[model samples]
Target: MFKAVINVNYKPSVLDPQAEAIHKALGRLGDDNIATVMVGKYFELTLNAPTIEAANDQVERICDQLLANVNMETYRFTVTPLQGATA
Candidate 1:
């Protein structure tokens, strides 16, 4: 089996109000060292694929179809083999 870790975030051009609020709150809490804050979604998925290529394909399709907004958000993922697991 393979494990996929996916992260979805807004594009650079898009405004992230939640992140902005967190940044401002951090500053109010005396966190001046922080330059910026970004909010995103993370997902962990297990797939019964035989190969890394197949796992990657599945992750891509999932992210493209359901997890991310193609117009406003972008996504990235990593696929790894699970220890002692079979497809």
Candidate 2:
């Protein structure tokens, strides 16, 4: 078994409305030091596969094909096996 951690975030150049709103709220709260904020998604999945290499490949494909939009969003992931687990 393996654990996959996926993180998705918007590009820096793109404006994030949610971040903007939070920034504004922070300013109202007397926190003007903040300049910008970005919102993103995180996914943690436990998968059962034969090998870590193959499982990682499959997870990457899933992220590219479905979890994230290649054109607008960027995604990165890490895979770790459970204790005493082979592959």
Candidate 3:
């Protein structure tokens, strides 16, 4: 078995309204030192793949096809073997 950790976020050129709102809120709360706020999505998935390479391929496909908006958002993921887990 394998475990995949995925993160999806808006591209640098894209405007993130949620992040902007959080930044403004932080300033209102007296946290002026914060330079920026980025909001993103995180997902943890377990796969029945027998190899790390297979797990990675599955994660990439999942991210591209479903988890991320390719036009405005980018994604990254890490796949690791699950300890003592069966496929």
Candidate 4:
């Protein structure tokens, strides 16, 4: 088995309203010095592929097909073997 940790976030050119709000709130709470913040999605996927290459391929497909919006979002992922499981 393989474990995939995926992160999906907006392109740097896009505005992140949620992040901006959080940053402002933090400042109001007396925690200053924050220049910016960004929101994103994190996913943990478990797969039972035969090899690391196969697992990576499946995750790439998943990210491109559903996990990320190609027009506005970018994504990266890491694949690692789960302890005691064979892939």
User: Best candidate per lDDT, number?
Assistant: 4
- Give the lDDT of residue 75 in candidate 2: 91
Regions of model 4 farther than 4 Å from truth:
none
TM agreement with the true structure for every prediction: 0.95, 0.89, 0.95, 0.95
Query: Candidate 2 — which pairs collide?
Result: none
| Residue 17 C-alpha lDDT in model 2 | 88
lDDT of 2 by residue, 14-47 (tens): 7778989999999999999997777899999888
Q: What RMSD does model 2 have? A: 1.4
In lDDT terms, how accurate is model 2? Answer: 0.89
Write model 3 residue lDDT over 1-87, tens digit each, in one string.
Answer: 998999999999999999999999999999989998889999999899977888899899999999999999999999888889875
* Residue 57 C-alpha lDDT in model 3: 90
lDDT of 1 by residue, 17-77 (tens): 9999999999999997899788999999999998899999989999999999989999999
TM-score for candidate 1: 0.95
Pairwise lDDT winner, candidates 1 and 4: 4
| Range of the 10 consecutive residues with the lowest summed lDDT in candidate 4 | 30-39
> Between 2 and 3, whose TM-score is larger?
3
Model 3 misplaced regions, further than 4 Å: none
Candidates in order have lDDT scores of: 0.93, 0.89, 0.92, 0.95
Q: Rank the candidates by lDDT, best first.
A: 4, 1, 3, 2
